[model samples]
Target: MPDITTSAVAPTRLRIPRQRGQAPGTSPSGPILREHIDAMIDLHPGGLTWRRTFPGTLDHIPHARHFTRYLLADSDHRHDAELIAGELSANAVRHTASGRPHGTFIVEINRTTTTITIAVYDCGWGGVPRFGRLFGIDAEYGRGLTIVAALADQVGYEGAEEVGHRVWARMVQPSG
Candidate 1:
């Protein structure tokens, strides 16, 4: 593996084309999204792994699993691939506090020579993650951050300035 101390670099933005006229489920949005993520993975000098998480709701898991399988089939490191389904499921639970039961979440993976980053963007009720003291020890909720922290070297939120919200994790890759 490359030196893990190398400074982190921003991912190169790829132009994702909008599918016009195509119905929501008819067009190739999922495949296009997967392709964009694969391009990012290709930029990594090291091997790459990817996974996706969906809403906890039964309706969304199929879509999530479909996209995740597409990405994982092309991955080189399945073992290190972050298990994001649980995190997104938790976010869905939080967002559904309103009466609406429908939402979507996406997870993308990318890496550089030494660092790997996983990002989960959701159309959830947006807010920064509440850390310690926000939830009690016996509480079943609020454990998403703990899972993220344990699995990731660093984690943070972004997109407060935008419509949707994204949570990301960056970690040093283990040598192959």
Candidate 2:
């Protein structure tokens, strides 16, 4: 693949066209916000990026995790990477249009000398992926993103509901 760099790219210059009267970066189905982000200062681009598309379903969550673990088998962050992959995949299926009939989600894993970035691209229509407050013990939901944020050094998302959403988490390690 060609080398992709974000050093010269500006988020303001990248805009997604939406319906008139609708929010600039929103969709009619849900409120997915676009984040203004810069590349992680500690991580460089031009690394090996592995991508896979999985049918959006709860049963496929393990597949996503397994794929991540397989890729990072020799790394110290393998467990964390797999867990992050599973959480993001679960969110895509449970909260986004990706769960609809025939919908699918894409998992992209990027590995640099000192960083591991995992991004999940969903079919959209779900609200912003944010860290939810730890609810009461009886609550069964709302912890996926929280756990992701805790394990990742950097986390954010981009894309509109009309198109799709890419929720990503980056785990950084000190370069030798």
Candidate of highest TM-score: 2
What lDDT does model 1 reach?
Answer: 0.55
| lDDT (tens digit, per residue) of candidate 1 on 1-176 | 87667464444333334577656545343332434654576675665756555544646644654454444443343323435544644464455321145555666666554566666676645565543336687997677777766767777777652456677767675433
Q: After superposition, how far is residue 3 of candidate 1 from its true place, in Å?
A: 18
Candidate 1, superposed: residue stretches over 4 Å from native: 1-80, 96-102, 132-134
Candidate 1 residue-pair clash tally: 0
lDDT digits (tens) for residues 1-176 of candidate 2: 99955454222332234777997656555422222122332244566789999999999999999899987765668899999999999999999999999989999999876688999999998877876566778878888898999999999999998898999999995432
Q: Model 1 — which ten-residue stretch has the worst lDDT?
A: 73-82
RMSD, candidate 2, Å: 17.2
91 Cα displacement, candidate 1 (Å): 0.9
Displacement of the residue 3 alpha carbon in candidate 2, Å = 38
Per-model CA lDDT versus the true structure: 0.55, 0.81
lDDT of 2 at 171: 95
